[model samples]
Target: MKTTIFTFHPDLKNGSRINASLAKAASEASFEVRDVYRLYPDFKIDVTAEQTVLEASDRIVLQFPIYWYQTPALLKQWFDAVLEYGWAYGSTGNALRGKEVLLVASFGAGAEDYQLDGRFHTTVEEVLKPIATIQYHTGLLFLEPFITTGTLNLSDEGLNEQVEKYLNILSAE
Candidate 1:
């Protein structure tokens, strides 16, 4: 399958650790990795180009670090711009129909932090409900998210292992 990973890390090269490594692994594994911030430093997203890329993909992966329980700014902008009224939803919007979507997110908090009785008092699934709604409305299949919790304190070995697991996930059918 032609899988495309749309990574939305603002300071990807310098600030990020896990996501940067995952991006490299995805690229090496032949999954098309589009670094949105790198491409649109000015935040001027070209809707046509974005749509073209999405149109050619069998699977679309939205990879990012969770920020205040929401997606980063550019990703939101991409969604607003690229997923137009008559292209991604509405009666005539069928471009993304039948496409599979996966969310790969890294959380600084541990898994326990995102539970009913945990620190945040909310599950990750609850946090991701809006995206699931989008998938439902747009006719995209929402796959189970690939999440890495406690990212703030991952060891080198653990990080490498996660990278390998990501590669495996991307390679899976």
Candidate 2:
């Protein structure tokens, strides 16, 4: 399957460790990796280009860090601009139908903090409900998410392990 990874970190090159490393690993594994933030630094997404890429890929991976329990601003914009009416939804919008979407998210807090009664008082699945709605609307198949928690203190060994796991997910058919 043809897999494309779209990374949405605001400052991946300078201010990120986990996301940067993950993107690098995916790229090295021969998967197409697009740094959305780098592609549209001013937030001016090329709707046609984005949609074209999506149409050509079988698996779409959205990689980002959970910020304030939300996706990065550019990703929200990408969804709005790329997944349009009569193209990705509505009666004639079956461009993404049957395509798989995987969300790879990293959290600064520990996994325990995302429990029902944890610090956030919510689960990661709850945080990603909006994407589920998108999947329903766009006819995209939502796969089990790949989550990495406690990024703030993840050791080098832990990050290496996470990269290996991420590659495994990307390589899976």
Q: Kindly give the stretch of ten consecutive residues in candidate 1 with the minimal lDDT sum.
A: 128-137
Compare the candidates by TM-score and give the number of the best one. 2
Residue 155, model 2: lDDT of 98
Reference-based TM-score of each model: 0.97, 0.98
Candidate 1 residue runs with Cα over 4 Å from true position: none
Report the lDDT tens digits of candidate 1 across residue range 1-173.
88999999999998779999999988987778999999999999999999999999999999998899888899889888999999999999999999999999989889999999999999899888887899877899988899999999999998999999889888999
Q: Candidate 1's error at 70, in angstroms? A: 1.1
What tens-digit string does per-residue lDDT give for candidate 2 at 118-170? 99999999998998789888889999999999999999999999999999999
Which 10 consecutive residues of model 2 have the lowest summed lDDT?
Answer: 130-139
Pairs with steric clashes in candidate 2 = none
Give stretches of model 2 more than 4 Å off.
none
